[model samples]
Structures are given as structure tokens and as C-alpha cells.
Target: MHLYDGHFGGMHLIWWIIWVILLAWIFFIPADIPYQKTIKDSPLDILKKRYAKGEISKEDYEESKRILNSDN
Candidate 1:
């Protein structure tokens, strides 16, 4: 019935849109938790790193590589 009432209605609609977008953002954004492991490296890749670091012997590296390759 009044201009001020229509303005209030528009404000309420904007508030609802803002809330929906905020909720969608909160639900859709990817979170990288520190404790969760996102396995980006392949098993052989990890084995190669271990061999390079001297954490595993060359013979062990070759044996593990053969086993892993045979799996596929």
C-alpha cells in the first residue's frame, strides 16, 4: 500500500538471495583438511621417492616396482 512497504519487501527478497548464495558457497567449496590424505601420488612414484631418499634399498625398490606393475 505504501512505497516504504515495497522497499522493505525488496530488502527481504535480497536478504533471502544472499542467504541462499552463502549456503551454496558453504556447501560447495572444497576443504583440504590437514589430517585427511588426498592421494595425489601413485604408489610407484612414492616408492621412487623413498629409493631416492635412501629410505629403501635399490633391490627392494626393484622388487616392489615389479609387484606393483604386475597388479595392473
Candidate 2:
């Protein structure tokens, strides 16, 4: 047995730093890029989102939905 029987040593601090950097990369990488669009939203998806956000009424939504569905 050596001296200094404590919990955290040099490697523990390094691991903590690695974990913090990994978490930061996971959380912020996608949002950090302003112009990089990962998922391309379709016209139907846009219409759905607009309807969900109250930008279009139900009647108009149904009419546009029918038009969009018939084209495909």
C-alpha cells in the first residue's frame, strides 16, 4: 500500500474532464451550427407544424392536406 488513501487522484480528474467534454459535445454540436439542417421537413410536415402552432385553421388545413395528398 502507498500513501494518500483518498478517492480522487489524477486519473479521476481526467475522467471527469473527458465526461464533461463528451456531454458538452453531445448537447451542443447540433445546435451550434446555424445553417446545417440535419432533418429536411417535408411540405406535409410543415403544414402539420403550422396547424399545430395555430397558424392555419382546421378547414384550411384539411383543404391543403387533401391537395397535398392528391399530388403524391
Best by lDDT: 1
User: How does each model score on TM-score?
Assistant: 0.47, 0.52
In model 1, the runs with Cα more than 4 Å from the true position are: 1-39
The local distance difference test score of model 1 is 0.92
lDDT of 1 by residue, 1-72 (tens): 686856677887899999999998889988887889776999999999999999999899999999999999
Model 1 misses residue 32 by how many Å? 5.8
> Could you give candidate 2's per-residue lDDT for residues 35-67 as a string of tens digits?
775788999999999999999999999999999
- Model 1's C-alpha root-mean-square deviation from the true structure amounts to 6.4
